[model samples]
Target chain A: MLKINNLSATVDDGNKTILEALSLEVPAGEVHAIMGPNGAGKSTLSYVLTGRDGYDVTSGDVTLDGDDLLEMDPEERAAKGMFLSFQYPLEIPGVPTMTFLKTALNAQRRARGEEEMAAPEFLKKARALAKELKMKPEMLKRPLNVGFSGGEKKRMEIFQMMMLEPRFILMDETDSGLDVDALRIVADGVNKLRSPDRGMLIITHYQRLLDYIVPDRVHVLSGGKIAASGDADFAKKLEAEGYDAYAA
Target chain B: MTHMPLKLENLPTRRDEAWKWTDVRGRVSETSAGLSVAGLPKFTLPDGITVSEVETDDLDTDSAMAKLARNFGGKVWAVSVPEGFSSDTPLIIEGLNRGHIRIRIDIAKGASLSVIEHHAGDAGGFVNVDMTVTLKAEAKFDRTIVHNDPADCVRIATAHITAWNDAAVTQHALSFGGALSRIETRLAGMGKHIEATLNGAYLLDDKRHCDMTSYIDLAVPDCTIRQAVKGVVTDKSRGVFQGKFHVRRPAQHTDAEMRHDALMLSDTSEIRSKPELEIYADDVACAHGNTIGQLDESALFYMRQRGIPLAEARALLTEAFVADVFDDLDDEDLRESLLGKIREWLKEG
Candidate 1:
């Protein structure tokens, strides 16, 4: 449902390119993985896709379900069912997670001319989802992501994604800071949410996460573009041999 | 030294030096009582505080100041702890005023109390209040000042605090309304082992203006003062903050710190801040900082990426920014009321 055609982008105007002629496609009902080394423009891809201000799209078109994504602001993208799980989730002090999540969910709903859900209904749904993710109810009582450990922060990201239930989500290095247990739990959360009508582009540096949530397709991103495409076996080989094979 | 025959010609309230930026003397001349305040809300507090003031519009300024300046002609309406009476319920006091309000509150010695003062008005008048707090030997006190009035009202408040030997005091001031508003906290540390924690937050919108000025004097040895002030400015609103920390030569072991941060929501919004530290003591720990900027774009992006709209994200960040001032409040009910006002202000901001 998401398509990137020869997308070349830079962090700023006339700056060094972060992504050069990078192109990828994730059809509906598919899960794609982009594995790359550090400074390999993995996060840049996420920023460019989400239309963050610093990322300048040099030459390319990003379309979501055949609709131009570049013309939309960050909030517009969110309204159109777009989500990005950041590598480092911001710690918003004094903003209770419950209040923040409801505001977000309702904003998305309001943009689509839907009625806002009552607090009781929201609490019911949120409490159930939080339980399934093994997140303590008290965690949601605190400020958004403040004082949460690296693992807890990643889990909260998944929790937020679950609450949004978006059509497409770009998870950028969500597994980097997570420990083994956290990775397993996070992988399970992602797997549980996978559906044929939804799409996700999982970006990471390692293939260990693949063992838990196997991808339908693997794209090796090197030199700012997808150099090779294959099945999950490609991920296994890349894990074994590293990016030297793709770099050459 | 002040009289209030509040004239409608003073619409913008910009007639005095302190009211230059926040002129409410001309634009408007009346206050609208919110639904909540009109009910004459009374807080449930401890320490047997019976403070009930009926607001009356007295057109004559000089006569009103002379009569109400000493607290409505009573026995100097003071709060005492019987030298050792300490109930942790937190002393709560409410004052009702319509036109010009003048009141003075004094806290007794060797006592500990948390007091919350709230001002709600709808008229284009003025409120001049003076609060003097004295901390006896080894005494302690904590105070919170909550201000929420419309753009047509004016509140010029002064607080004078003196901490005796081994005394500790903390003051938190939160302002969200007023046309030409200025709250000054002047503290004198005359006692050794004295400490003061001062924090303030203000939000200005429309053509609104708010000023917060503080002066803490370390007149004795081994005294410490800590201050932090934050503000959010929007519309064509303007705000000013001036903070000064002074340490005398005899205050050798003095420790003081002051920091101010401001957030401008609109391009035309204005923020002015000045921080000064004067220390003649040989050994003292003093630091001060001032920062002014717009909201964080990265944080906004991060919030929006998770399905939060821009406005919602901005409100969340603004709440977080100002909530820091209310951290030291020991009373729960008063804290919640102030926090609720903060939420409403951000939504309207």
Candidate 2:
């Protein structure tokens, strides 16, 4: 459902190129994991796809369901069914988690000519989802991610992903800073979102996360391009070995 | 005191450091021609409070504006809360026209009260208000003053407060600037173990100007004072905040902190802040902070990425920036009302 063809991007006002003609595709009903070493443009790929500022896309194209995604604003892309679970979720002070969720949900709905959800219905759904995610109702009342622990932040990110129910999901280093228990809970949340109609791109440096939410296809990212493509066993091989051989 | 004639020209000019940013003299000279005193709205006191109109020639002629108010023959209104009485309902005082008003409030010993004074009018004139509040020993008092004047109107308000031993006083003021608006406060901690909080916010747009100036005196031992003032300026609006904390020699264990933060929503918007501490006590804690900047860009982007439009994200973040000023307020309805007003103001642009 999501395709990136020869995507070349730069950093620092084009002073440095992070992604050099990188190409990848994740079809609907498939979960693709991009494993790479440090400075291999893993995070850069997510940011570029999400249209974050300062990461200029110098060439190539990205499309979702045959619609051009690069031409839309970040929020427009969000309304077009693109979701990014930030590696370090921003602590937005003053915007309560519930309010943020409702706004996001309604914004996407409104963009698609759908009626806004009533407060009661939205709260009911949010409370249920929050419970299933093991988040306290009180946490939803606090500011988004403010004062949240590392695990809580990761869980909240997944909570948002589940609530938004986007068509394409981008997980950037979702395993980092998570303990074994938190890893399981987060993996369960992601696993529940797996469906035949949605596509996911899991970007990570380690194979520990793959053991929980195993990917259908694994791609080794080296020097901004896909160096090797394999099945689920490739992640285990990288974990036992390392990215040193792929660096060359 | 000398009976000098009150003249608009005698108002503090921009050359004076305290009035430099506000330019009150210039604004008065330009807008004082049509100034007149119109009828005032009737005030209804809440439970546990009494109001009486006192006929007295005694007036505080401390400044040119005060002298002008005295010359207008304004009646003195005294409001008092009896000793040992406490009430949850706040006294609501509304100002609806251009006039000179003098009010004195007495919170008797062991009494507690909350007062909300709202000022709004459509008259294209000026209003001068002088208020004095006395909190007796062990008394508690909270006051919030909100100004929503028309664009052509001008408001000059001054308040003097005295807190006795073990008394606690909190004052919050929010001003949506008119053509020219200023609120000056002089507060004193008269006895030991007093606590005082002074918080204010100003939202100005277009060519409006608002000035909040205060001088607080910690005269007795073991008193604490907290002051926070925030402002948002847009278009050609101007915001000024000047606060001074004085710790006397007898106030040995006094603690005071003052912070002033402003958000400039437009390049032409101006904010001038001065927080000064004058201490004669050797064992006192006093500090001040001032900052002026725009909203955080990262926070804005983060909100937008979550599907919130850019404008709405900006408004939410700006509202949050100034939300802490009202944290100490206990009235939920009033706090919501004030926040609603802030959101309305943010949506105006």
On TM-score, the candidate that comes out on top is 2
Instruction: State fnat for each of the candidate structures.
Output: 0.77, 0.62
Name the lDDT value of residue A203 in candidate 2: 96
| DockQ, computed on Cα atoms, for candidate 2 | 0.66
- Local distance difference test scores for all models: 0.77, 0.86
lDDT agreement of model 2 with the native: 0.86
Span of 10 residues, lowest total lDDT, candidate 2 chain B: B30-39
List DockQ for all candidates: 0.57, 0.66
